[model samples]
Target: MVKEIERKLPVVHVCTIVPISQTVGANRIVPAIAIPHPLGDPTKTEEEEKVIRRRLVEKALRALQTEITEQTVFTD
Candidate 1:
């Protein structure tokens, strides 16, 4: 599946609910929020979680605009 994607698309970004280790088949990918949640943990207030999610999304957006050759770890 990963090979097919890499063969078909020049650029691809992925978001996962599971940890990175689970995607052992994919060749190249960008990190993303967890799968089902797509946001931070549930310990914070709604407002606080919103802010964190926004920040994480912004970082993902930035990753799309670059042409680097290595995996970038987008900090939340």
Candidate 2:
């Protein structure tokens, strides 16, 4: 799905596991919080978790804006 989409539009894959994203040909990858809750942390306060999730979403947006010739993982 990622590769096929990339052919027509820029795409970012936000996942907890980066290797799997790379294996599947995801060009832009954003490291996520966990497998069960990729965008959130249950241990955190609800408000805090929202902030974390927002940051991850912002990271994905940044990844979409970035230009790369090969697979890239945006950890920051």
lDDT of each: 0.57, 0.95
Per-residue lDDT over 7-67 for candidate 1, one digit per residue giving the tens place of the 0 to 100 score? 6764434556324523554433446556666667577898998997787667656655656
In model 1, what is the error at residue 42, expressed in angstroms?
0.5
**What C-alpha lDDT, on a 0 to 100 scale, does residue 66 get in candidate 1?**
55
What is the RMSD of candidate 2?
0.7
Per-residue lDDT tens digits for candidate 2, residues 4-29, read: 99999999999998999999999999
Candidate achieving the largest lDDT: 2
**lDDT of prediction 1:** 0.57
Candidate 2, pairs of clashing residues: none
Misplaced by over 4 Å in model 2 are: none
- What does each candidate score in C-alpha RMSD? 3.9, 0.7
